[model samples]
Target: MSRTSRVLYLIVCASPRARRIGELVGRAQARGWTVCVIPTPQALKFIDRPTLEEQTGFPVRSEYKQWDITNPLPPPDAMLACPATCNTGNKWVYGLADTLALALLTEAIGLGLPLVVAPALNSAQAVYPAFDRSVTALREMGVTVLYGPGVYGPGPPGSGGRPYDWELPLEALQEKVVRPERRK
Candidate 1:
């Protein structure tokens, strides 16, 4: 089947906000994007898979498909991993790809695709030395990290707080990813 060219692969993690990810798909589709949600293994428990599939007209995949089966979606024009956890973020930093989400992230970074990450970690978790270094490493490599004081601030520890704006990832995708390409 011929795939739409402007595809977006949204990697959803296991945050409480994961349930609302259909909001992201709706927003992206309004902007002429075809969104495919790739969920983390544990994220399935948080999100409504059937609803998400209905929303985006695609499956919310969490595992690697068989080798004989061709990939379903088109190459992503951009990638957004929102509400990322400390574990996911740090693993991405260390080149871990045990999951399809991390594998896609690592490969997308290597391909120089437009990439955005919004972490939902609190202050205490953010204090980890690896978290600091991981954010710095990703930033140095041109990754758009929606973290820090005004953005997705390191809130009080164990508060399970979400970021300031749910739309930040979409905004980043528009500003840093889609819009930049339009200029050419």
Candidate 2:
């Protein structure tokens, strides 16, 4: 397979905002990329495996399965952790990878897969000292952390609507993580 056709591993965290994960997955696959959805245990509470599997046309595996490590295939070409929670972000920064999702991310980073994380959390949680430290560490490690849309989806009128612009994260990923091969 060509470079672009190499596998793309997606780590979807469980959160109310995770409803939008499908859109990201669909868009990536439409660009001639293969996507593997590995939802966090918590994320599965919001989005089921079957639904994600149907969308990505591949079985969704959460924990490290018995046969996976032995396959001996190269790591995925790209890794994206969308709707990454404050918990995961904080844990990652401190190098506390207890769960399979986090462990996979740790491995991906170590293997030099193009990695990006789109965080989704409340403003309060976003500003936690741990969160700040984690973000800084990730950036220092050359990990692209896509700025979120700030506020969740649409809110009540006069509710201060969306905080930041969508282009912030879109452009961040487009410029740093995603590099579609130029078409002839």
Candidate 3:
């Protein structure tokens, strides 16, 4: 039987805003996309790898193993770096690949695949020089960087401290992953 070819890579960062990664993953899967998550060590603290693995029915890789290339997983049709922390976003925009997510993202961009990033940072820090340069670099490299909405407080009121009704680049991701590629 042929398998459905929908695949997406989820890259999270170590930040308070990274909490939304799971919800985004769930929504993606419900849309018939197979998600492969690559979380940083810091992101793992916010989410559970086992839970992600079970939900996606794929391995949730945190590290790049040199010897694991015997069987390579198919490249995702698109990559969504959700809740892109201030640090991770800047690092990736400047072509820093110290982490597995950045490395894979670099390769994805090289292959001309769609890369959508949703940046999550406070107003004060988001306006920093490094952040500005990083955003510019990513745009120059054809990476779609979505600016976060201006929401104050811990999030939802009932949550006692959590971002509420923030903008996610879901439409952008759906546009890429669900669209059928045109054959030449």
The C-alpha local distance difference test score for the whole of candidate 1 amounts to 0.83
Model 2 bad stretches (over 4 Å): 1-4, 67-74, 148-171, 177-184
Clashes of each: 0, 1, 4
The TM-score of candidate 2 is: 0.77
lDDT of 2 by residue, 76-183 (tens): 777778778778988887667777789888887677667777777766676667887887788777778765355233234333213434334434445554453311
Top lDDT prediction, candidate number: 1
Clashing pairs in 3: 154-161, 154-162, 155-162, 155-163
The total of clashing pairs for model 3 equals: 4
Tell me which of candidates 2 and 3 scores higher on TM-score.
Answer: 3
Question: For model 3, what is the error of residue 13's alpha carbon versus the real structure, in angstroms, after optimal superposition?
Answer: 0.9
lDDT (tens digit, per residue) of candidate 1 on 1-184: 2465488899989887787788778888888889999999998989999988888888778999999998876778888897788889999988999999999999987888888898877778888999989989888777888887766777686566453466788888788764555311
Give lDDT tens digits, candidate 3, residues 55-161.
77777787887874652445678888876777887777667899888888888878878788776666667667898788778877777777634423123223322
> Local distance difference test, per candidate?
0.83, 0.68, 0.70
Quality of model 2 by C-alpha lDDT: 0.68
Regions more than 4 Å wrong, model 1: 1-5, 161-164, 178-184
Per-model TM values vs. the true structure = 0.91, 0.77, 0.81
Ranking by TM-score: 1, 3, 2
